[model samples]
Target: MAALGSAGPVLLLLAALSVLSVAVFVARLIALRGASAGAAARADWLDAVEGGAMPGAPVGGGAPADRLLARAAALLPRRPAPEALTAELEAMGATEVAALGRGVRTLEIIGLIAPLLGLLGTVLGMIQSFRALELAEGAANASILAGGIWQALLTTAAGLIVTIPALVGAAILQSRIDRATDEMERVIGRAALAAALPRS
Candidate 1:
């Protein structure tokens, strides 16, 4: 309680950032894990449906990629021309990938700002410390200045602690989205090629 009371408003802001960073990281990680795990399998299903002449079924996996595939499967009945099919699939794929990217930019923004905010807090703390030392009329010792400096430095540490995990989580989530994108392209390209072939 005393520690909280002693902390400047900047430290409180940093504390909020730390909590927000952790929350976003955890949620995005879970969502990306599910989406990445389902993407390959859904791709296979989509390829089999469009290329291998297998009867299509609803893709019930609930991932973004799975939903995209499900939408494509639903379109099979119309026998869309190959170019039209490719365009539709490409558009839908872009949308799904974008959907997966939700909250990712927030992580990136938080990561970028946290350290700078910490530095600002430290600067403010140092200003307060020096001002206090001046007001002490030469009565204050080195220990008082030293304690104030350390307290100010605490904000910088807090900022870095929030930033590191947010950045790492953002990177991992982005790579996962990239892999799913590759899978979608591979599957969609092959399907388009197979559909363009003359029937047996």
Candidate 2:
């Protein structure tokens, strides 16, 4: 608490940065989770679509993933070749995955840059400490020296607190991206296989 108080303007700036970073992180988390969950639900959707289910009929009031699968099904012509079918499915999956990635890069950047800003503050604080020492002429003022050192350490701590969560959030979102991509791939593979099956 004292460290933050001693950090003065830099502390406030870091606080603001933290707030913005957290907001971005939360937004990205929500988006990635929603996308991944939707992708996971695609299995049942693909099954229903392949079974001649009505286009608009609820796959048990299916979700966004189901809707996306339905769209892809419509795109696959009655007798599309495996190669063309694969291409179309890949394109659709890429589009959905890209949407899930939105704002993730910003969170990563915040994680990286916040620490640099804190380091800058640390440097400035150390300089102030040395300047005060010089003024004291071989007898540094304990109060001034302590104040400067406090500022240096506090800024660094603040930076780390902000950065750690941001980095963690980025990692989580990245995992979600990978999971979503994998799910989409699986769905596409199943769809292509069904399309290629021989009709009795």
Q: Highest lDDT: give the candidate number.
A: 1
TM-score of 1: 0.85
lDDT of 2 by residue, 1-200 (tens): 54433356777888998999889888877655555565534666667657755244334323334544665667554767767787887887777777777877888888998888788778878888878788889676688788788889888898899899888988888887887677677767777876776644
Q: List the candidates' TM-scores in order.
A: 0.85, 0.81
TM-score of 2: 0.81
User: Ten consecutive residues with minimal summed lDDT in candidate 1?
Assistant: 1-10
Model 1 superposed RMSD (Cα): 2.7
- lDDT values for all models: 0.74, 0.73
In candidate 1, which residue ranges exceed 4 Å CA deviation? Answer: 1-7, 38-54
Cα lDDT of model 1 by residue, 100-141, tens digit: 888789889989998888888788778867877898877988
